[model samples]
Target: MTILVTGATGTVGRHVVRHLLDHGRRVRALTRHPARAALPAGVEVAEGDLTSAAGLEAAFDGVTAAHLITFGGDYRPLDNGPRIVELAERAGVRRVTVLGGWREGTLEPALRASRLEWTFLQPVQFMANALTDWAGPLRATGRVREPYGDRKSPPIDEHDIGAVAATVLTRDGHAGRSYHLTGPEVLTARAMVAILAEATGRDLRFDELTPDQVRREWVAEGRRPDLSLFRAFSEVDGAGQADLVEMLLRLYGTPNELATTVTGDVERVTGRPPRTFAQWAADHAHHFQP
Candidate 1:
């Protein structure tokens, strides 16, 4: 089966491609700049756009399924996801998996309304996102300054997200399912700092800042991120994103014969356990070092 993976070079999409290729499936990776797409050797790289459907004619050709990322350009997944899925259906494709959010327009509604079998992957938060808080400063001073020191969350590993996507794309019985995926443990920023410190054998500090201080710092750094997004980072109702984190812990202990947790889902689908935050840090130590 030829699977076309959009956002083929991103954190999640690269894993999707790698997982598919590891399973011996034919893969076609889509990117705007084909020259820059550093895909695996056997996979085909096609130049395409998810915004206007201008360069996607050949992308869907002979593709039996597709992994769709909601962004391409202008963040118009509402306009483009259906068009691409329509093209896939026209080419007799059977499955479509979407990496949810990260797009301006809603692609879920369009996917649900289509005839194609589909799965939505909504991870609560990526552990890799934590790297943004620490990696830059770690390279400079081995310390991270951020707001809400006690905030905790169940962060999903990006590789696990990819494994689940590969399962939904390649196998059967996953259609019409929306998976709220997350990690096995709920960890605080301080707790994770300790983990990284342990892994790298360096003293890493999590300096707690007030929300106002964080926003001012970001503004000073020339990154005016949306206030709501920043607020979500600091919002701690006892456990910081606790509602979703609790749901994840509830799902984690369930039988593997039933619904999936972050780790079990990746293991069940990929035949490998999900990488932990420490493992991720160890693997990416170069990115954290001076």
Candidate 2:
């Protein structure tokens, strides 16, 4: 099966390509710049734009299934989902796995309304998102300044997200399912910091930040958070640094059963347990070194 993996160079998408390759599936990695894709040797790097239907149509050729992101460049919403679906149907593509949600944009609705097989991979939060803030600071000073150090969450590994997507894309019985995936354990921010410190053999500290302080930090970063997108604790302007941190604080600190809960969805689908945050820390220890 020729599976077209969109956002193929992204954190999760790259792993999706890798997992598919491990399963011995033919993979076509979609990117705007094929020359710079740098995917595995066996994967086909196809130049395509998710926003442009004309560009997307060509990539759908001979593709049996697809792994697509809910949004496009700059985390922008893809409004041309129907057209993309049309092209896919025309090309006889059967199954698709979306890495986001239906409420985010028209893509999910379009996919659901289509005759094609669709599965939604909704992860609570990515463990890799920590590298965004902690990596640079740890690399420079072995410290992190963030809010809600006491806030707990079960952040799923990016690799697990990709693995689940690969399973849904290649195998049967996953269609029409919206999986709310998570790690095996719930961890507080301070606990995660301790793990990282232990993994890298360096002393690390988590300095709590007030929400106002984080908002101010966002201003200093020259990329402010868009309050309109705050429903998901998402920011449109930034890499969602402030928004996501605030979200973690809120989700874990409060009595919100949804975010702080752990589930076996990953293992249930992939037939293997989800990796823990400690394992994630060990794997990313290099980023925390002084």
Q: Pick the lDDT winner.
A: 2
Indicate which candidate wins on TM-score: 2
What is candidate 2's lDDT per residue for 28-100, written digit by digit as tens? 9889998787888999888888988767877999999999887877566788888888999999999999988
Candidate 1 at residue 70, lDDT?
A: 71
For 1-290, candidate 1 gives per-residue lDDT tens digits of 79999888987889999999987899999998899888889989998877767777788889889998775443333455567767777888789998876433446777788889988887766877766556777768877665666666667789889889988888898899877677777677688888888877887787776655644555445443333233332333344343433333343323332222333555655566667787777887667767
Span of 10 residues, lowest total lDDT, candidate 2: 226-235
RMSD of each: 7.1, 3.7
Query: How do the predictions measure up, each by TM-score?
Result: 0.81, 0.88
| Model 2, global lDDT | 0.82
Please report how far candidate 1 places residue 250 from its true position, in Å. 25
Report, for all candidates in order, the number of backbone clashes.
0, 0
